[model samples]
Structures are given as C-alpha cells and as structure tokens.
Target: MHKKKDNVFITGHRHPDTDSIASAIAYAHLKQELGVPAVACRLGGLNDETAYLLERFNLDKPVFLKDARASLDEIEMDQPITISLNASIKDAMDLIARNNRSLAVVDDRQRLIGMVTISNLAHIAMGDTAHTIDLLKRTPVSNIVRAIDGELVYESKTFDFNGKTSIATIAESKLKYYELKNRLVIIGDDIESQCEAIRKGAAALVTVWTEKISEEVIQLAKEFDCTIIKSTHGSMNTSRYLLFAPNVREVMTTELVYFNRNEFVDEVGRKMLETRFRAYPVVDDHDRLFGFVSRYHILNSHSKKLILVDHNEASQSVEGIETAEVLEIIDHHRIGDLSTNKPIYFRNEIIGSTASIITKMYQEHEIEIPKNIAAILLSALVSDTLNLKSPTTTPQDHIIAKKLEDISGLDRFEFAQEMYEATSNFKNKSYQEIINQDIKKFYLSNQEVMVSQVVIYHFEELDTIIDAFENEMDLFVERYNLDLLVVVFTSVVDNGSIVLASGKLENAVREAFPGEDRSFLENVVSRKNQIIPRLSTAISKYVG
Candidate 1:
C-alpha cells in the first residue's frame, strides 16, 4: 500500500491526544514488523503525560513533527481523492467510500481552496447527529471539485441522475411536447423540435450527428437556463443518460475541513478525539483533497500518503486519517476505519490483544518478530488494554504480552507502570516543545498566515506551559520568523481545551473567530480547516 516509502510516517491529529501518540508508536512498530524503515513522527509537541509515558516505557520519541513546509517537501499527492468544500452529502459519501487518496477542492484554475476526507464527509453527513463535529471550516466552497460523475439523485429543473450513463433524444416529430425538463435534446435538420424546445423548456438542444449546436436552439436553451454537453454519441445515446447530466463537480465537497499537504498526524488525532469524523480531506495550500483521511488512513499513515502496519482506528490512528489509502492492517482489534479495495491478507481477529495476534501469526506462519518489534507490540497491548483490564482484551493478549515480555526481558507490570510514569511526568517540558514534538505541521504560505499549534493533555502543566509560551514566543518569532502564532492545549479526557496562549497577531485572530473560545477542538483546533484559516486571514491582513 505504501508505494511511496520516501514519504515519512506521521501520527497525531489536530490536537493529538494520548491514544493518538500511542497509536503512532504502535503503527511504527507494525511498519518495522514488516521490515520497513518507517518513522513514528508527530506534528506538535508531547504533553507531560505522554512524555512521561514514553520515558517510563523506555520507548524512543518520534523522529520529529516538522513544519508543513518540511512535510510538503516529503510526500507526493499523485493518485488523488478529491473533495469539494461545498459537496453534497451524497457526493462526499461516495467519494470517501470509493477510497480516493488524493482529492482537491479547486477553482477553475485547478487552484485548491481546501481538502476533505471520508471522515470529514462522514461528520458532515452525520450533521447534527454529532455536535462534536469538525464542520464550519473557514475555507470557502469556491474550492470546487473538478469534473466528477454522479447519479441525478434529484434536480431543480433540468437534470436527472441516471447511474453514469446518458443519451440525447433525436427530435424527429416533436410538437408542443418539446418542452424538455429532465432530458438532453438532439435536433435534426428539420429544426421543428429546436423551435418548440426554445419556446418550451429544453435545457440543452444539440445537433447530435453534427458537431454544432443549432444557433436558434442554443439561444433558446440560454433563455431557459440550460447547460449544453455536446457529444458525438449521435444525440441518441447521450439523451438517454441525460439523467446522468450531473457534473462530476456536483458531488464533490466544495466546503470541507482539510489540512496542508504537510499537516501533522498527531494534531489530526487530537482533532479526531474531539469529533466523530472517521476521515477528512488532505489538500495542498490551495485546499484540494490531495488525499483523504479515514480511521484506516490514519492507522497506517506514514506522512501524507504512505501507510504503515498496525492496529487501525480513529482513536488509535495517526493524523490525516481521511487521506491515505490503507495498504494493509495488521491488528487484532475489530475492523476499524481501514478499507481496502480488494481482499488483502490483513491480520485482524477477535483476539485478546493485537500483540498476541501478531505473535501467534508470526509463530504459525514462521515469520520473525524482531526483538524491538516484540517489545513495542507488548508494550502497546499492556498499556492500551490496561494490562488486559479493558473488556476488549483477551487471554491471547495476555499470553502474547507475557511471551514478548520474556523475549524482551521486561517485567510486564513494571514495563507498564514505567510507561505510565513517562507519560505522566509533565513538569520540565515547554508547552510548545511538548506539543510540537508530538505534532505535525500543515503549511506556512505567503497567501495564508503561518500558524503552528500543538495539543496537550496535562492540565497540571498548563500554568507552567503558559509561562514557557512567552519564551517560545520570543524564540518562535526569531526562529521561524512567523507573523501570527496560536497554540492550543487540549485534553481529550476532559473533552475541552484551555486556550493556553495567543500571539501579537491578536486582531486577526479576534476577527476570524468573531468570539473567543468558539466550540471545542473539533470545531476550533481542527488545525488546517478550523484554526489555520483564522490565522491565515490575520496574517494576510497583517502582511498586506
């Protein structure tokens, strides 16, 4: 699934939380399990709790959660799964279900306004059913979808959805009935239907066999507000499927929440915790769905497009969960956001733990589980299911955890306890470092404000983080030379974020967010879509 290995692997959501960090670690383990040199990365810094957990577990920290600029230079958006910001619920659902990886919400110039994902669409489709949704993205609907096809599910006057096929009607003996409402029209040299269609309501009048549209008919259609799709289908077949006249753009998401090509996976995970969207869109600075994010996408996500291996789910997944194509899922959890086109040998089962499943599979199939791999998997199972405390856990998980523990020469209880300590040890680190280390960057462009934010879970560390923010601010202003800055500290456990710090570009932030502390992270700290755009406007104004 990961044809692009050069693309780095990232985890973390808009404001990556505990599970998000652990999940990325688990995913990186799976990648190494498959003999790939995958990097467990973050966009923001780790909070005190997560940092303590990692340190206690003696696990290595991520490679880095660099800026979006660093990320864009890393991944490629070739086979895209585009989304429109203003896409219909039906269209968004289909595109996400189809597993499109690179998607774009573009204007006429193919310029991206923003991107979306299956999860983002799912949130939109779910509508009010879930208040903790990532809707009301700041990006515009002008981020239109390129030409796409859709069934004319419903039409105002002239179009119909007919399952990707259409036909043009040859008006041979047309009379007063020539007033076409939901059909494509093809006129003959006789031109009676053309005149009647003009007077009636022919949306499109075409000279099928010929390359031309009769001037009078064309003029008539213009008066009736009809779009002409000229085809060599002899006006006969094209008219038949006129029901499918819907522009492919009709179904694309025109208004959506998307991240830059280099959005951080950790931040995305944090956002996911706050919402129920299983996927979302990943786009360029222009906001096109370069790829999609889903529960599966994030689970195996490595950077923007490539996928690693491991337990796949929105809760246990990486960032941009909506964008990447899931190559494979080697987990022991229930079938999660991961969906593959064809049957692939994914190792999911109703087992005690993913580690147990992996161990048994390795033994039965004669596959080797590296020492480090064994350690990582065992640690995840022990930490995730609370050493088999979770109802989702099984005996197999315990057995495998024990076996892996022996192989790694680690005590199960001690290892788990230590990992807990590492995550909880929250004091010395800066909020910026804590968030940044475990986060991913989306973008920093001239057109949009350069914004970087991280999600933290330790409320106990907030007061300290706030103090550290000023120093980081001084450093950030000099280091990155940014215009506006906004950092968010979100605790998924509490289900809210404390607006820890804000920068000098205050007016812009104020204007973009008409009020202070809008909704939760899902609505506010949704990184690329909800948060960055606010800063971008301010920066645009400030820079301008």
Candidate 2:
C-alpha cells in the first residue's frame, strides 16, 4: 500500500455532483499517467446520477476519504521490536540495547500485553534485592538455564522453587548456617554439600564452574525432588545472572500508553506531550504491535498532499482542508474562500463544467483519451450543461462535448436522457435524500446559505411531492444550521424552475427572482450562472 504522504489525493467538494466526481477521476488518471502517485477520493456518498454513469462506464467509485489530515500511518516509525512475555530479562535487555528503544512484550498470539524499557531492565539488574527471589519463583526453569548458561543434570518431575536463593560455601559448618529450605542453592563441586542441599528441602542446586555432578548426587536430587543445574560461570557471575533470570513480564509495565496506527498524528502528538516517555508503541486495530512512534516522527511528518477539482471553497472542501497542502486546483466556478500558502497551478475558467477543462487538458498534452474516461467526462458535461440548454453552457463546452462524444462513441443526448431517467424515479427515496442529492453550501454576505437543485422531465412530477418537499426543507434548514435553504425544481422540457425557500432569509429568495408568487423563474436552469449570481446580489442588497 502507498503511504498517505506519498500519494496525492484528487477530490471534489463535499456532496459532490456528477461534474465534481468526474473531474477528480479524470484528473487523477492524468496525474498517474504522468508518473505521479495519485488517487481519486470523494468526501461524501454518491448521488444516483453519478452512480449510474460510473456503472454504465464500468468505472469503480473513488475511495471515500473522511479528512485530509496526516495520520500515524503516514509517519516514519521504528520497526516493531518485540519480545515474548515469558522471555528472560536478559533477552529483553539485549533487544533494548540493540535497538536503543523499549520493547513491546507480546503474548503467545503476538498481541501487545506490556512494554519493557531499558529503565525497567536496569532496575532489575542493579536495584532489585528483597523481591528478586520472589520474581525468580515465577520464572521458568528453561529461562534460568539459558540466563546462566547452565546444564540441567537432573530434572525433577515437578520443579517448584520457593523464591529463596543462597550460596553454599566450601565449609560444611558454613553450609549449615545457610538457610536452604525450598531455595535454589549455588555452590562448588563438593559432593557432600550438594547432597546436603538436596536433602535440606532445597528446590534446586546449581554447581558453578562444574562440568558434571556425581551419579549419587543426581540420585539424591531425584529422591528429594531437586533440579540440579551445572553452570559454566563462577559463583559470583552465576548468582548475578540468576538474579535477572526471571521472565520480563515481572518487570514490564503493564499499564501502557499506546496509539492506533490510524490515529491522527497531531492528536498523538498532543497526547505525547503529557507524558515523558521517549517513544510509544503504535498498534493495529487488533492491538497487534505495528511500530513505535516518537515525538521526532511527529515533528518531521508532512501533511497530506491534495489536488482539488471542480470546487475550491473551504466550506465545500474535505474536512481538515486547513491542515492539508493544496498542490493544485482545477475548477470552473468563481473562486471561493480557499487560499494556499505556496503558489500553485490553479486553473479556473468560465465554463459550464470542470470536465470541459479536464478534456482540454488531455488534448493539450496530446495523450490518447481512454474510451471509459471520455464517456464519464461526456456524462459530466451533459449533466452540468443540461445538454446545452442551461445558461451556463458555453460554446467551448459544446465543442468539448462533441470531442468527448466522438471518442466515447456514445450519443450525448440519449445518454443524458437515460441518466436523468435513472435519477427521476424517487419512489424508493426519502425526501431528505432527494434534497441533499445535489446540494451546495454558499457563504453570502455573512450568511450560510444552501441551494439544492433537482431536474425532472416534467413539472407534474414535482407537483405531486411539493408538500412533502417543503416540510423536508424546513427540517433541512434546522438540521444544517442554515440562514436560508432553497430548493429549485427545474423541468428541462419546460425550461423553467419552481423555487421553494425556507429559513431566516426566505424573503431574500423572492427578492432575488421577482414575480407575483415569487416562486417561479422562467428560462432559469443554471444554478452557477443564474441562481448564484442573483442570490448573491439579492443577499448583498438585503444585508445592506
């Protein structure tokens, strides 16, 4: 999978329409063809019209992205260095020394259970005293043998040690003074001392610098249920190694502060500031260790790179747009409130659809426009221009549409009819879905206004649903916290629209388009060219 920072996401505005979705897909394809790692993404669900076009063209829907912020998955992290919970402390210390970082202690399933840092190991190696034997009791025999580099001469069927550890001296009288009950005793090769340690209820005996134990001593150990280990190290080294031979689980920190790989880097950084640890473990959804993320990683991380299509307004763009690096903008609308820190390649034109601009780009580059791409671009141009009927349609749009129609080998008029028919069937849709299908939010004179447009073949279809549509519009205003909400139902056959207004500035809609009823506009079909300009002017005048 490509890292998030390595891929440039080409996305349209929120609640994308056919033109928005199509322009992003085409631009991303062009960028990829030029060897840039680009991906097409959408901010919201697909409308019926856009979905129909994609299915007809055999194109997959773009990935849905929630925001444009950098996440931990994009940051460079240390590879996961892990140790098992049952592993010896020496093993953890070695791993920490090699990586110079804490190790994630995992269970049998490789799920993170705790963390062992260098501090935890140092405490065990230097400061541990009274509880050292208590810890060793929980440690396994295999760990002790591996820690001390010892051999198990006699293995008890059930090896149980009470945690007490002592060294038996060469003097037999001194051995008597040493309490060896149920304890692990480290001593020299004196056969009598070894036998006495086994008989005195000692759980295990380790003979330091001894290659072998006598058969008689082994027999006595078996009878007394004592495990005999022959260590290659001297007494001092064997005792020191034994002290740290316990499983790392005894020293690891069970309560840990970790982050999920999908977490936003800024959020993780904020959490890290509250703690003093140098690094924190990053895990997957299943709590499996993914890597370690430190403050250094967050400080060096880069924001997501983006190339906008169709719209440029911050309110209409993806969430976290303020934190993203906008590389380019290919749009047709009058510029909205989005600004980039660095100068970028911005292409904005007075055309009917952004698809027209992208179509020209393919021609300018002299690249062969793929058949499927041409088909979707033609659909977007037809939908946005309303088949050359909407006032936003330019002569250039007509020229580009013809070029796309020729390459796609599809009749634009027939395809437009089919696309409109697919969306006109509202029998299975809720009123909210129909209103939000092609909604756009605008900032007019310090007012948050929303305008939604729905196209139909005849005006009669809207007449049947006018009452329900008005009720839903009222709810839409309150739900979205809008200063005004307007729904325009346009009939392509009649070339007119019936407008309904709701919210605090409902009268502004009537003032924008004057009439006796103030609800109908003749020859007004283009929201970009006719509705937005008139509404903007009316809102400005109303505010003044």
Candidate 3:
C-alpha cells in the first residue's frame, strides 16, 4: 500500500479540540495503513481539557499549524498550499473548501505577490479597512505606467507598495527637476491662466480638454523647450488623478511571512499554532506576497483523505477538520457543517461509541483489529461515553468495551484508574526535559526565543519548580542560542497558571496576558492546554 508522497496529508480546524486530536491520530494511522506520509494538524493553542484527554489516552497532540500556506525554504513548507490570489475570493473559498486545509499564496507575472486568505476576504466583507490599499496593489506599476506616455525618469520603479514614495530622497530628485534649476515651461492651452501656470516650472505640458491646437503655443513651447504631452484620460483627470495614484510597492506589506511554492502539510502544522497570525502571508525569501490562510483553512485542509469516526460538525470534532478531505463520517452525532468531495463509507446511525461503528467496519471488511488498536478504540469509547453515563451512550459501547477488555488483556476499570493517576502526576518533571521535550521555536522581528510549559494538579508545585525552571532556562537559551526564553505552569484544576521566564522576555509575557494580577502557580492541571496559551500570549506581547 506504500506510495511515494506526491503531496501532504492534512486534517482538522484552527483551534483544535479533543475529538480533533483523536480523529487526527486515527486518520494519520489510516495513512500509515496505506503507506503514505499523512499527518494531522491544528491551527490554534490546545485547551486544558484537550491536554488532559491526550495525556489520559497517551496520544501525542496533533502538530500546530503556522498557516495553510507552505514555507518552501524550510523542509516543512515544501508542500505548502500554493493557491494564487489572482482569482476571486469565491475561488479562494472554494479552494479552501476543496483542499481540507491549504496555505494561500498570491502570485502575478510568475512571481509571488501578496497573501489573501478566505478570512481576509471575509474580513473585507466585514468592513475591515486593512485590505483596501492592499487590494488595489494587485495591479503593478508596470500595468499602470504602461498607460502613461511620460519619460522614464525613474526607471527603477519596480518597488512593490513602497512607503518611501511620499518623500523621495534628494539623491532621487533628478527625476523631478533639471540641472541648474531653471524654471520649466509648457503650452497648448486655450486659457492664458493655464499657460501662465505651465510657464511657472510646470515639469509637464499638455493640451487641455479638447485638442486645441495653436501654432503660437507650439512656438512658445519650442522656445522654452520643456516636455509636452497629450493624455487619453483628459488633462483635468490626468493632472488631478495621476500624481496621487501611487504604486502598490508604496503600501504593500513588504515585511511579510511567506512559503515557497512547495511545503508539507504535516511539518508546518506545529508552526501555525505557535504564532498568532490567523494567516501568515506565503512568500519567497525575496519578499513577494503569496496567497492567504485562515483558521478555516486548517479545518478544511486535506492532503490525504479520511474516513472519520466518532463525531461530526466542526465544533465537536477536531480543529482544522476542514483541512482534511473527509472520506466518510461514522458517528452517532448529528451531522453539522462538514462537506465531502465525494461519496464515502459514511455511517452516522444513532449509536453509542465510534468504536462500535469501527468494529462493524472491521467485520464488514473481515479485517482484524490489532490488540493495541483495539485497546485505543476501547479507550476512546470509554472517554467519550463515560462508561455509558452520558445520554448519548449506546449498547455498542458496552459490547466493544467487553471485547476490547478481553483482547487487550486488561480490566477496563483498573486501566481507567491507573491512567487517571498518571494524568495527575504528569507535572513536576525536569524543566528542560519538559520544555525542550515537545515545544517549537519561531523568531519575532529577529530575536529567537524558546517557550515551554507544563500543567499540574497541585498549585504548590509552581513555587517548588521555579528555581529549577530558571536554571534550566539559562542553559536552554544558551544551548538553543536563543534571544529569550519562558516556561509556564498552569493549574487547569484552578483555570490559571504561573509563569517563570527570563527577565528579558518578561515584558512580552505581561503584554500578552493583559491583566496585572499574575502569580506563580503552585501548579497547573493541564500543561498542554493551559500553559502553552499563556506562554504564546506572552510571546506575542513581547515578540514581533
């Protein structure tokens, strides 16, 4: 079943939830089943509840996403979404829908231009003013200047949305005035006042509104010898509108984050989660704008198709659900917003556990579930139904639980108890081991920083762990050669966390958190969910 990957596999929504976590793990397993390099990814930070669930199940969280668009320079971005912005927003939305989740990059003249995401257009419809100037930038100076018949004073007008046009440097003054600084001249206007204005250093001369020809005016022009011209837009329109019309290079977002034409879906997932921008512009290192990405792109992204189990509807399902190409939905919940590209083995009967539905699939295929997989599916059913306590539980859960208990050789009650205790003891480990364990890195402006977090059950552990964290951070920053560093502790049991971080990055942490009433936590209850957010918030406040 193995095949060389021609593209990346994507799954889920921007802000991932537990169902997203479980489904992604399952879907990735499905890909491995086919010998494909499939990965499940999420767009936003993990919530506290999700961390607890993942730890309880002993499942690795789905990687975080940077944007749907890929960054090709890095190996991770090699298969990034490469959609162009030359098309309509509807086209962009359609692409996002069809691709599960994809990175958006805008291009023109075979060069990466600016980024535009589905949300960017949505925000435009919502009356956001940020995109107005950027939209018109689609037409380059080459296009507009092609309409003009003037001397190429500044042959170097290749800049895109440049901000410096308002005040050209003295070195560039030659484009406007002549050497020796004599007053410029002009002619061919019926109004003497117009002629007078032209004579007063009028760098340009044009025949006004009609082609009012005059031999005398021509003679004055020959004497003064300044440039003369005629424009199709008419003298009034041209004189008033031309100069104010600046190129996109004057206002385009030059300092942009972008991806190469190729990038992988799995690799960039963790990156998208670490940063705050809902959509990072995809571009080459030369700084051209690509397409755009949004939170929805993650949900709808798909490089590898999936047959979903357990849940439907974006809210209850995993994050970046849209980013996955849904094959079939086998669930007990009511179907919500999910759309499939084609028909699949979808089974949404009124049942208890997805494990039940999956068990049926195995029976129909006559495929045996491996012992470990059976153990996991059984665990998923137990977590979702709470041992048949929830109203949604069905007889199938009880049956599967019994079968899985027999096959996996473990008592369900005993296993659940042991797992719960492990979840509670998940904290108070080595600070560096915890931080450098699963955390990722990104640069702000230009400074590199490392962020790590752990959630704990007991609040007192925060005080006990700070000194250890500080020592580890010093070594971490130096070892990673980072500019700043931070470690956070969250007590999901208390819905808050205490952060221990380098003084250099402390201000950044404060700005992200907003409220001043921060304290060192005794410990956090869910490190994955609670601590990472606070750490990221601090990073956003202080970093670029």
Candidate 4:
C-alpha cells in the first residue's frame, strides 16, 4: 500500500538570515498548534547571526532541505515477491501465476541474486530437448519427486546417476535395447521390468500408477544402489513434469536492472522509459530487496507539499520549487515572479520583518507563544529593523515588537547589541563566507544579478578584506553566470554602507548614486527599501 505524504514544509529563502529562519520556525509552530502537520526547513546554511540567536534561545535549527523533488519513498510500490534460488521451476511458475508478478530470486540471507518471470519459466519448459536432461545432474532428488507428485519409496546411500531419461516397455527383453545406464526408467508396475531395469545400471525407477513394488525388485534395486519413486500419474504426465524438475538457479536471469529507494521519481521515470522491463526491483542501501516499482506507481505519485516564508520569488525559494505544491506564502517583502497552479494563502505586508507578522499570527489564532519562541521572534524583529532604527520599520512593527517584548521579557536593545557583536567578527571568516552569509539573487529585465550584504560595527573593517572580497566576487559572478554582482557592507552605528561592484555591469553602481562617492552611501540601512530599488532603476536605465 502507498504511504501518504502529509508533511507541509515551511521553508525560508536561500542564504537565510535571522528573520527568515525565525519566521519559519514560529509559523510552523503556530500551524502545528492548529492541527496541521508542518515542519520548518532551511534552504541553505545558517549565518553567524542566525546561529547565535538559535543557540541563545536553546532551539534547534530547522531541517536543511536540498531540493523539493519527490523521491521514490513517496510512491506506493508493490510488495516484493521473492523465491529461493534452490526452488524448483514449477514452484517459481506457481508463484508467478498466483501473484501475477515477477519474482526477485534471493539467496539464503535474503539478498537479491537474480530475477524470474513467466517468460523465463516458459522458455525453459517449452524449449526442452533430449539434451535438456543434462540439467538433472544438479537437480536434487527431493525436487524431482515434488515436481512429479510422486513418493520416494527408496533413497540410495550411494546415489549415482547420469542425467538421462528413458522409457521401458512391457517386454523385459526390449528393456536391454534401451540405454538404461544411469538413466531414470519410467514403466508400469511390472516386477520383472523393474528388476531388469535396476540390474541394467539404471539410476532410478519411476513405477507409474503403482503403490507397491515386489520384494525381489526392491532387493535388486538395493543391490544396484538405485533410488525408487512411485508416480501417481501415468508415464506421459510423469515424463512431461520431469523436464521442469531442475532448480531455478539454472534458469533465473542474474543480470538485473534495479533502482535504489532514494532515487528521485523524475529521474527514475526517465530511466524506466529507456528500458523494456515490466517492473524493476527496489533495493535498500544494503542491497536487500524492498519492493517493486512499475510505471503505474510513477504515474500516480505526487510532489512534495510546501509553505513558503520570508520571500516569494522563485529564484530566492528552494531549489526545484517549481515541482513542489506551494500551499501558502507568509512574507513581508515585495512579491516578485512566483506563479502557482492554484490560489494560495499569500500574505505579503510592507513591514519591517516577517517575524513580526508571525508573532501577530500567534495572537490572532489565540495560541500562547512559548517563552523561547517569543525570545527568538523578538530577536529576529530587532535584527531586521535595527532595533526600530531602519527606514522600513512601521507602526505595526513597533506595536508587534512591544507585544513580543512583554511576552519574552527581554530588553530589545541589550539583545540586539549581543546579536550584532556575534556577527561582526569577520576577521576569521573567508571572503566567500562573508559574501554568501546573506546573499540574494534577482532577475532585472533579462539580466541575472546577485547582491550580497554584510552588517559590521564599523566601516573601517572593510579595509582589511576589500581586495580579497573583490577577487572572490569576480569568481562568484562567473560561477553563477551573473551580469552583475554587488556587495554591501552596512554599519548601522554609522548609518551608511560601503558598496563594491563586479561583473559586466559594474559601472552601473556608480550611476545609481551620482552625487556621492562610489563606495559610500549615507542613511542606507535597508537593502530591501534602499539598495535594490536604486540598483534596479540604474540597471533598467542602462539597458534602455
């Protein structure tokens, strides 16, 4: 049976900051309180600022999601039908006919060794020749008896046989003309023919339609070290069933085509189209068989379910967001280019932080916010709005921050000081880490651009790493195929930023603010409200 996927993932955008991570966690917690199955996830690693806040609040980080594609674990597959390698071909055929599916041939330890299908058994059963009797050399005596529905009356201690089969007539004299040397002789219940066949070096005797053998013939068979079986059917049926008495190891196909359980469904579908098999085996990491996957399973499977937070643009969301089912979006940024198949619960407000919106959601739903959750939500608000000092801070943001301060019982100014100190230590971090700590991507007209930001205590700190930062920015632009790459180092204490530019459109940074120096911008604390709009305007004018 198929396992239903019910988890609704709440994720923030790539290169998450404190506000993005905190909003997802709080929103998912609120959703769970309302009886929804929700889990908070992160599209990328935590920055220094987010890590400090989570550690201070003693909360675990959200789950790191690599992509939104559905894996084979989400699909319903048929239960595995397996058979032993030592079983008879008739046993395999019986299982195949009953289940109407191919079988995975496993060894003693239940590890997959081969595969068997109806066609594999049919080819061996219908294409038998006299030379096919050679297979009986490896066939067990027990299997032969089971295949023909016969009883083993005698089992020799020193069994010896050439893999051959023949029929003996009622004429005892004509039995000598038959090649009875180490051959299984099938005949009626004639004591004379049974004794004669045994004495003529026959390996075994199948007495058809008989329940008993004479004492003299039994003694003779013991003297010849020959096994004896009494078949319930006539000679014709016994001979036909004997051809399939060999073990399945000789007929099973060993070269297998299979899939791992963790393989993505889209890639598995593409691989299935290149092959002609009806079904393929699914195995775990240990090579043990789990089940079987067919084309029907792929056709009916659904993608993962998600609820986006913090940002709404497709480029800023998780990888493979186009394939996931987006249920809702709760953000405080300008909506960009995310399109969904159906109407979603989209809540976008021009506020300071998404965490403020989430804090208000908890109050609207009448769920009491836990102390630790309240503290982290307050921290995210203070970090995003610069403790109510940024231009983007609204009256609603101040009202929500005051409400959260009462619930969390933390001084916002002291907590913000601690958060800034924790993130401002860039002396040990590499240029790549500094740039990627809080980065975003955008599509302006037809050009792809990347903007990275770092919040520091002082503007002079950039003098130490400015050369390395610019060198890495060049490589970053080439790696991501960007038309422009900009890095903004903002000092909230100074209320200004030092911006650097790289890539094909580096000159546009100078044109954005023509009166000021290219490196410095006063009273620019919010990238959402100040930096992106100026850059977008400049790039649009340059392209025109």
> What value of lDDT does candidate 2 attain over all alpha carbons?
0.88
Estimate the lDDT of model 3: 0.49
lDDT of 4 by residue, 458-497 (tens): 7778777778778899998898888999898888678778
Is candidate 2 or 3 superior in TM-score?
2
Comparing 2 and 4 on lDDT, the stronger one = 2
TM-score ranking, high to low: 2, 4, 3, 1
Best by lDDT: 2
Candidate 3: worst 10 consecutive residues by lDDT? 162-171
Predicted candidate 2 versus true structure: per-residue lDDT over 37-61, tens digit per residue: 9999999999988998899899989
RMSD of 2: 2.2
lDDT tens per residue, model 3, 305-397: 444444555543444455555665666555656676667766776665555566556656556666655666666555444444444556766
Per-model lDDT: 0.50, 0.88, 0.49, 0.87
Q: Each prediction's TM-score against the native?
A: 0.33, 0.94, 0.35, 0.84
Give all candidate RMSDs, comma-separated. 22.9, 2.2, 20.2, 3.8
Check candidate 2 and list the clashing pairs.
Answer: none
Q: What value does the lDDT take at residue 410 in candidate 1?
A: 82
C-alpha lDDT of candidate 4 relative to the true structure: 0.87
